[model samples]
Target: MKKILVVDDEFDLLTTWRLVLQLEGYTVVTAANGVQALSLARADPPDLIVTDWMMPKMDGVALCRALAADDRLMRIPVVLSSAAERTPPIEHPLVEFHRKPLSIDSFVEIVARLIGPA
Candidate 1:
């Protein structure tokens, strides 16, 4: 099973993503903020990460940069989901950016493509 880490400050969004990804048969791990997300990733890296840009502590852009700088975690694919007007520069080749308020099908398709075969 593919492992996914979802990072967002909102509790409801975190729970919703966990449940949605779990239902899709992916092993889901969640973090309420970028700091916790980075900690979890260092402890046990997920195959893919879905993060919100406006998170407290580190925020998604900083988190992405940090992960990209780390050789061990740089290879992991990252998908940024946000409603922000500005998009962060994808420092790593494996990173992808997407807008928020995503439809269920679009989310599933992106997740499936990144993680592969659910």
Candidate 2:
């Protein structure tokens, strides 16, 4: 089973994603902020990460930067979601950006494309 880490500040959204991902057959790990997600990734890296852009302790961009900085973690695929119009520079080949108001079908398609079907 593919393991996916999902990070979001909103509790309801986080729980929803976790349940949805889990039901889709991916093992899901969730965090309320990028800080916790980063720590969890370091300890046990997941195949893919789906994160929200704006967060309390650390944002998705910062998490992506930290992942890029780490040699061991740089290759993991990242799916970043944001509601804002502005985008942060995401230079990594494995990183993907998704605007908020994301559809479940589209999100599933993206995940399947990136790391195989759940």
> Model 1 compared with the native: what TM-score?
0.95
Give all TM-scores, in the order shown: 0.95, 0.96
Q: lDDT values of the candidates?
A: 0.89, 0.91
Regions more than 4 Å wrong, model 2? none
Report the number of the highest-TM-score candidate: 2
Q: What digit string (tens of lDDT, one per residue) describes model 1 on residues 1-118?
A: 8899999999998898899999999999999888999999999999999999898898898899999999889999998888976685767778888888888789889998887866
lDDT of 2 by residue, 32-71 (tens): 9999999999999999999999999999999999999988
- Where's the lowest-lDDT run of ten residues in candidate 2? 85-94
**What lDDT is reached at residue 89 by model 2?**
91
The residue pairs in collision within model 1 are none
